[model samples]
Target: MSKYFKKADLILFIIILALSVLGFILLRKPASDNAQIEISIGGEVTEVHNLDTDAEYIIETEHGYNTIQVKSGQVRVISADCPNKDCLNFGAISKEGQIILCLPHKLAVRIIGGEEGLDAVSY
Candidate 1:
């Protein structure tokens, strides 16, 4: 290759390497533990602990009933007594969007941020 072309290629390669290193450094973030999910029942929210690795939950509502099971680091509703049972069919949700709702009891199970010394309520 010509001398000019060789120099240009080297410069391009160095620029690319520098950019990659910078991107890696800038994009890096400290790893955080799994968030502690809060369970809300009857307008009262509380943290659930000692979750059974293979434990299942039963939610009863005036409208219907729903069963939830936890496995593989995720929670899901397995069955329901409601006519539609649509919520039970929602499958398992591990991310923020996943929710289990029992219309009859007005109960909801969802994943929320971990207890980071945050206040329970604000006036």
Candidate 2:
């Protein structure tokens, strides 16, 4: 061939670069430092916690009990009396949109503004 790199190759490279930059912008995640945690029990909002400070919280509902620990702008379920320790094993989450769910206890712990994916309109 006369050319080692054709015009098609250059066009393809430009297309890939453009797509990568667009993808990065579209999927950019929210910062977790200013995020908040939402605790939902039995489909109701039980508590809200700010990630700026460290604290410990005990949750007791008609279903069961759970102990939540927050430190260094991260949150996790440390202890739970539920039969399964699934929620406790979720570990610490310092990212937006992370979640810990306790099915038997009907509890859901999630961080707001931490989703690292495209939103509804973008999706």
Candidate 3:
């Protein structure tokens, strides 16, 4: 405790830090085992695949082409004919809500969480 930071200040700081950590633990979305990948072209959803499957897809748009791969519960853009090649740098995404976008080809790959099935209360 210093002139500026008294015991009260230290207690308040510790309380705030504890609350922050608790909030993150309670609010963060957990990775879902039943996640799936959704592919979109020109803003329209084109395909949906299960994360448990391994596959590759070559999407050809009017502007160019992009090669995407899904392997071992993760999906990424492997190659593309786009001029910038920025999409390839986005790397792989496995968690729900993660997305990889190829602007030049109007292609987007996104991971979505589990299906909305009937819960215990609904039965």
Count of backbone clashes, every candidate in sequence: 3, 1, 0
The residue-by-residue lDDT of candidate 2 on 47-100, one tens digit each, is: 888876699989998888999998888789999999989998899877666678
Residue lDDT tens for model 1, 6-119 = 877989999999998887565433222444344666777743632224567665555556676777657777887766666676676665434666665566777554455445
Q: What does each candidate score in C-alpha RMSD? A: 11.7, 10.5, 6.2
Identify the leading candidate in terms of lDDT.
3
Tens digits of per-residue lDDT for model 3 on 28-73? Answer: 4544777778989988999888887899988887898898899998
Cα TM-score per model: 0.52, 0.66, 0.70
Clashes of 3: 0
Candidate models: Cα lDDT each: 0.61, 0.81, 0.84
Q: Which of 1 and 2 is ahead in TM-score?
A: 2
Model 3 regions more than 4 Å off? 1-30, 118-123
- Candidate 2 vs 3: which has more TM-score: 3
Model 3: how far residue 49 lies from native, Å: 0.7
